[model samples]
Target: DIAHQNKREIYNLLMRASADAVIRIAADPKHLGARVGVTSVLHTWGSAMTHHPHVHMIVPGGGLSEDGTKWIACRKNFFLSVRVLSRLYRRLILDGLSRLHKAGKLRFFGDHAKLADLAVFDAFLQPLRKIDWVVYAKEPFAGPKAVLAYLSRYTHRVAISNSRLIRVDDRGVTFRVKDYRITGPGRHTTMTLKTDEFIRRFLIHVLPKGQHRIRHYGFFGNGNRTANIARIRELLGAETPVPGLAHDNTIEDADAPARVLALPCPCCGGRLIIVDTFAPAQHPRAPPASARAAA
Candidate 1:
């Protein structure tokens, strides 16, 4: 359990590394050689409420050219090659794990105790290099609204939504799950698990304290996003029908309120404003040093 507890860190590292790899590949002179933007959201559960960590990234169909004077559009119905992305993603994650292991940042216990040994750890990671990892990319959304709607569904989701829950009686917990193996209506099925097992599975998906499940990268990064985006807009030309394009405003900029108000309020169709700020609750203390070392 202690070893598995750091999965949130692993997930974050994997996604960030994979995104960097994608950007590097996409920016290759032979490929696109343009600056791209990506918004990645981490999902840690499957329909069966199992620990199935993955990232959903939204990337524009094109990017700004390296010269910052032109826009580069990708080929129709295609982005980066998934096969290349998968291979790179696998390597990055495995290498990251190896580094963590060597740094004594990773813990091991119970069935995974052998991984504490350097030889065993190396052996454990060796097999991963041979297998293909999944790194998928879909076609661009219809519009900015479509992208926002899609993000809203996943950005805040938990292991299992209330709508999927059928019952939680003394015997166990029941929920509806989509059996992707079958097609159409037949894929929908109900599953029941012992109460303890259900809770255990759900708890595994709970992220580490203060961990951000959503992250932006490349041109979308917080530091230079404003300037980079403004250049992209200029390259695309004012006549282009890019939805939701507006003036750039850095967090330090005085025009930050204008940026905040740009988002429409869902309740009354007015504007969202930051009326107050508060510090986050303190996280519970970790296991004792001796307890952790024992694991």
Candidate 2:
């Protein structure tokens, strides 16, 4: 239950981290009073392709002044220091989680059941302090075009691509998992998993109903997005996308299920047989075969 709870939306913790990040980044006088525009994309993948949830924030290093008069930009390559961001992020997340526990908003189950007691909860969260929760920063995508390319690959991706699955049979399914195998001379390897187990592992990542897995915060808050965009435009004093400059890329991979067969369908734990699959580029609106559309 704790695992489920942890994976589900922790809105308060998310917001707290966002706020702290914006505060730290914006408070620096070196920004020369530039505004901030950031879109935080929630991602839950590590090198192992496991459910290590984290955020990939797309931010313009600098923004227009609040008055929409001058454009500002950060240094060419650096965003805030990852070390600082990690420390701040962990603290803010923990503090918010603690607040939720105190307010009786957090639910505990399994071995976590004892967390109902304040002392027990404190002890449980204590170890979190010792472990440095991972915070990584890839060099910002090149320019607007590069940023778009990067997002195209991740934004709508499902738990696992159908191409990764070799086959699904009654004798435990078999599917390919990423082989982070190093290349030395002619050495290469790919990992595979059994079907039932694959579905089980994939199911672990299925988010709850109506949970906005990816969200934006700070100056990029949805409510203020339009006005903010206009403000930013004015600050930049840069011409908008040239008339013919506007272009789009659309790719259609062979239809396949974005998830592996290992995860069971919530409705009956039935195997989610692939009727079709769509690539990240062409994310078609569709419902999960295993469950009703989340309201």
Candidate 3:
């Protein structure tokens, strides 16, 4: 609710704090002692189109030395400590929220109106400071192909997809949703909401104007990203990466073309064959406004 009310401030704070947490922790000699780069993408909606704001980050396992002379690599099969990251992230976000409240940048409404008062707002944030905020770091991707595959899922996803829309009528807008609590096939279910409510939920994810959903930090930052990447590649002796690292089997290869019936039919377990193709029909135009009003 707070995030929806103050989308820009809250999301900006999340990005800043998350990036700061990783950079600070990794910079410490006890951890990795290097300046790592981070690419973060902000997502505001969950599977059911609920307002669940989160950031996904992709960080390389190593970084350049402080003096810019050598590369510092992390221990095998280990990155930074989750506990350390969680603690630091919690502090940074809470501190940032406090600053926002003090600067009168935050808003409160309806039942939460009392939070406008300093005491009330501090009380609200007290429990958050005590409890650990989760900052889960999954195992590193297997290779560049795995990294590309993982990033493809979230980098450009929307609140909902057309394929999930089951129906739309006077009853409501029925759509498919996944219940994360369920363990198996039973997790998939359908949900229906009034058209007005559906629009309201969808609009919650539309970011404030000019607010970028994806941002890069450190070496991947905009100003000198290309040069920084080239330097890093030179240092790692990977200036020329292997063809397999860049290969994606999902795309057709021009040199070695695939068979016409290489792909299987979606509905049947048979090879798909190309048939005849035709131009698409144009959609009918809507009646004039005068006619619509008269009707």
Candidate 4:
């Protein structure tokens, strides 16, 4: 799985696009010398958790100035423009794919045999050029707390949440379907599937082990994240972050992260210690179960 060059190449191209896009944006006088971090997480599923591959990126609002002199604060209400970002992202990725095709690095499958031909490939991409690629940019979180809570969900994740797999009946397996509209975005609505189909759909999201779907990039590149972050703060003329602020941006900054896990306790901004938890069978047992009882 990881041995496939196409997957690796595609992954690289996506990373490059994010980095390049940031560079393009930074080059603009508006952005100054933005030293923003980009963290991209690979997700190969759609609302039904089907094999609809895409990446999610987390990005800070501003970056270091070009000269690393001042922090280039982004507009309070926005990140890069979704329309423009999408166009740039799509062009970079499609161009990479086209290059691979021309270099004989990409392969056409059984029915895609025509794609093996350069002319056919060119024709195939013709429509893509006309289509506005799906680059969505949701409003940045309300506050820093929201950002941390959001990152926790994707910093690590699984293909399916337990609440979704309702049952494994003959008629089909039952799970939740999310009506992003009605549920007011990132909310789940229920749906079902045949047992086999359920497995198939779920399997599509299974990443090859060791191939990390979650990744960090740019100022958060790990090598000199501290320095880059410092440069960014300097550029924006901001105070050194006290703590819990997001300097880590991502590959898929378009959509918001899924909120499967709980957020830090709002009542107490400080750490909320978890004393213990009960097992499924023992959960909510008796009239009033206590933490000690579960232990």
Best by TM-score: 3
Clashing pairs in 2: 160-258, 173-194, 173-195, 198-262, 198-263, 199-262, 199-263, 200-262, 255-277, 256-277
lDDT of 4 by residue, 97-152 (tens): 88877788776566677778898888888898888877777788888779767766
lDDT, residue 214, candidate 4: 63
lDDT of 4: 0.67
lDDT of 1 by residue, 26-134 (tens): 8987776788898888887889987777788888888878777788888888888888777877878888888888888887777888879999889877887998787
Ranking by lDDT: 3, 1, 4, 2
What lDDT does the true structure give each of the candidates? 0.78, 0.64, 0.86, 0.67
Relative to the true structure, candidate 3 reaches a TM of 0.81
- TM-scores of all predicted structures: 0.78, 0.71, 0.81, 0.72
lDDT by residue for model 3 over 68-180, one digit each (tens)? 67789998878899999999999999999999999999998998889999999999999999886889898889988688667767787889989999999998899999998
Sum up the clashes in candidate 1: 0
RMSD of 1: 11.1
Where is the poorest 10-residue window by lDDT in model 4? 244-253
Off by over 4 Å in 3: 240-295
Q: After superposing candidate 2, which stretches have Cα over 4 Å from the reference?
A: 1-3, 9-12, 15-19, 30-33, 45-50, 66-68, 179-189, 241-295
Worst 10 residues of 1 by lDDT: 244-253
**Clashes in each model (backbone N, CA, C under 3 Å)?**
0, 10, 0, 28
